[model samples]
Target: MSEYIPLKYYFDRDLALHLADLIQSEYPRFTITSFVESVSTGVENKELKARVEVIANTLKQHLPTDYEEALAILLKILGPENKTEEGMFTNGYFLMPVAYFVERYGLDHFDLSLHAMYEITKRHTSEYAIRPYLIANSDRCMTYFQNWIKDPNSHVRRLVSEGTRPRLPWAKKIPPLKNDVQNNLSLLEKLMCDSSRYVQKSVANHINDLTKDNPEAVLTWIQKHISDNHGTNPKIIKHGLRTLIKSKDEHALELSRQVEQGV
Candidate 1:
């Protein structure tokens, strides 16, 4: 009957109902009764870690076969928050589904997960899960990215930067980006001026991650786009300059000073 119990105990009918009630309280507008029931029936209630893994695997299995339906269920279950009432939900609950969607439909059915990703990422922006969805199907994702960069929805464009992050959480590390990271900066080349604060943050993080392997490239980006994005946005300035500051690079320091002086 705990507020924050592990997934391993979901099999106990009493425990499942209690946990479901707590989650329902958190998200009164949306209900996850079916998923909770499915979890309760599954043997995942034995070992916590194993149970979570099983759920992740199950979601993965479902993605390729019946993605539209599966994604619908996932998005509905995740629900909205106060500030934004969309498919925003807890990161932990969506991890398995995200991972599964990436593995199953990332190649042939990018659209199947793309819409759902746009929704779930509003709340659970796990870098780990987003990375594979981008890398495994970079070409396909890029096709969508081409269309999304200009779409009215900032959430879609945010995925452009977020999905390609090198050190994204729970995802495998892409060494190519990590090594000559600057090469990958083109992914967000057009997103620098995205109107959404959330989308802009993802753009900044993309630049921040690149700085580790390519300081010069990041510097060039900042300098070239300085007039365009430097002074106006805090996220761009901060994330773009993170590496230079961390390395104590001289030019970066000068730029920081300039931004400060402008302020």
Candidate 2:
């Protein structure tokens, strides 16, 4: 097996150069060298997320001091729709910093930040960034997500569920959702039969995360949904109950029909 190299390494000087070239092309005043110098120094020691934060903070120093103005500059320079073939950490990875930019600077600008996130999500996920918003502005952010459930773009729809997971991986936990699992489940219900596998997968992962803290609630929720939509809900139930089934929880195993009678 190959030695494991942490993902943070990919955000190297080369990526900074690529980003600098893109920025300089759009805004003549952009000092590409300065941006590179700031990002490259001692960046290798940080992990993936820390490195991303370093880049975003460095960008804040170089771009407009006003958050909205800086965000506008980014929107103008963002590349075309991310090609499916490009891995998340490859081309278009610059959006990671953009997402962080929103997380760090756009909190107070609620509507504007969501609009930016909606646009950025189509290119690279704003899933990580959206969490803080959801935490800080629960009602408003939840309402935004409710509307996003019907977005024409699957990525936008996926964010509705992915961003609200009580325990989304690689991201902070949403305390409100953790304390009140029903709040999170309500949103998942809205997306139970999402057309896109991309969206459904997120919905399933969200439900599975719920299973950890509230197995009975999740199991009951899965059973109810499965009974209502036997065709599609089964796949989601299977995924949602994956952990419970693995632990041989009788209700979960029986509901999944992975075992008969007592066996």
Candidate 3:
């Protein structure tokens, strides 16, 4: 049997070499040797995320000074979009460095960056990349979220919720998203009964985060979602309330029990 390889190695020498080949295919001027040397050197010691940052920063150094030009070239190398919701990190691993490139540098160009994220997410994900936009420009980013919540792509719709979670793992907290509790839950309301399990799980997780800071509000909103008879999935409520129930909140416990009993 082939030995097991850790997921971090996905960003290792082979990926760097592969990325160099793709970039050269699109941009003849790309310095293949330097990019691979820079990306692979000392990368063995770094963990997954650090390796991703190394590649993203390396791309910045090797790509053109003009961000859009560089981004356009990177877009060409995206190859094919993953057709299913599964194994994004595996099937579309190559997009990670590209997404990080946009997340790190695409801030100043809102429309361009948003469009890029829309495209990249269809294959992998822009969940982490989209957070910076919320931090830098919540009002406008929220507008994009509003539109994206209804996007036909499940991955795109999932980004709207996951990107705004109050306590998304490995992502910095957005004070605006945390403080704007009512508006945040309202944004998630549209996705409450979404048909896509991927999108629904993201919605539940986002609500789970809201529960930490605004228990009363979250519980109340969930109660409304339940009582409204809108055909919202019971799991969104049950999983969303897990943290609360674990904390032994009376309201959360009772409500969760009720949902389990189909009340």
Candidate 4:
């Protein structure tokens, strides 16, 4: 059997050259060699986040200095290709650096940054990048999420739940969502019955994250929705409560019907 490489290796010099080629193809003036040069140094030694920062910093040097213009140029280079299948990660893996760029440079321009994120999400995912906006501008970011819940792209819709998770793995926590359970539930309510399983899985994971801080709240929610509208809600609830069910939380197991005993 062959050993698998860690995900961080994807950001090494090969990826830098690949991205540079993609960008230079669209914009002839792009300095591909310079971009690769800046990204290649010290990148192999860094971990995942440090590698992302290295590429983002290198991008800043080669792309337009103006954030909006730089974002536009990157989008143009990314083009309109999207994943044809649900739950596929390989389709846009190359665009992770673009998300890092948005995270690093897009804070000051919320609207433009959000628009860029929406576009980038169609190609890859801005889930990791969007968390900072949620932290920096909770009200505005929440509003954007409410609207994005209806976005046609499954990735964009998935971002609404995945990006707002209080303890999303490999990403920073959003204190507002962590501190206010109701606010998190509000968004979940809108997505509980999402048409796409891709989106539904993210919603399930978001609720599961909530369980860590407030198990009772999640239990109550599961009980209320367990039998609603032909049992779809129960499936989602069960997935969300997997941790609680495994830990033998009396109410959670009972509500999920994993046990016959009453709480």
Query: Which residue pairs in candidate 3 have backbone atoms (N, alpha carbon, C) closer than 3 angstroms, thus clashing?
Result: none
Given candidate 1, what's the lDDT at residue 199?
Answer: 76
Query: Candidate 4 residues 144-263, lDDT tens each?
Result: 887898888888888888888888898876654636888888788878888888888888888889898888887776666554542345567778888888898888777777322221
Alpha-carbon shift of residue 171 in model 3 (angstroms): 1.6
Q: After superposition, how far is residue 190 of candidate 1 from its true place, in Å?
A: 2.5
- RMSD of model 1, in Å? 6.4
* Greater-lDDT candidate between 3 and 4: 3
Off by over 4 Å in 4: 1-3, 85-88, 176-178, 227-231, 258-263
The TM-scores of all predictions, comma-separated, are: 0.65, 0.90, 0.95, 0.90
Clashing pairs in 2: none
Winner on TM-score (1 vs 3): 3
lDDT (Cα, tens digit) per residue for candidate 1, span 1-263: 75996544642444445434544554454345654566556644366545545555444443334656545545555555224423333324434434444454544556766766655555554344545556565556667667777866665567677767775554565753434555466666677767778778888877777777767877877766665643446557666778778778898887777666664
lDDT of 3 at 228: 76
Say which candidate scores most in lDDT: 3
Candidate 1, residue 208: Cα displacement in angstroms equals 1.1
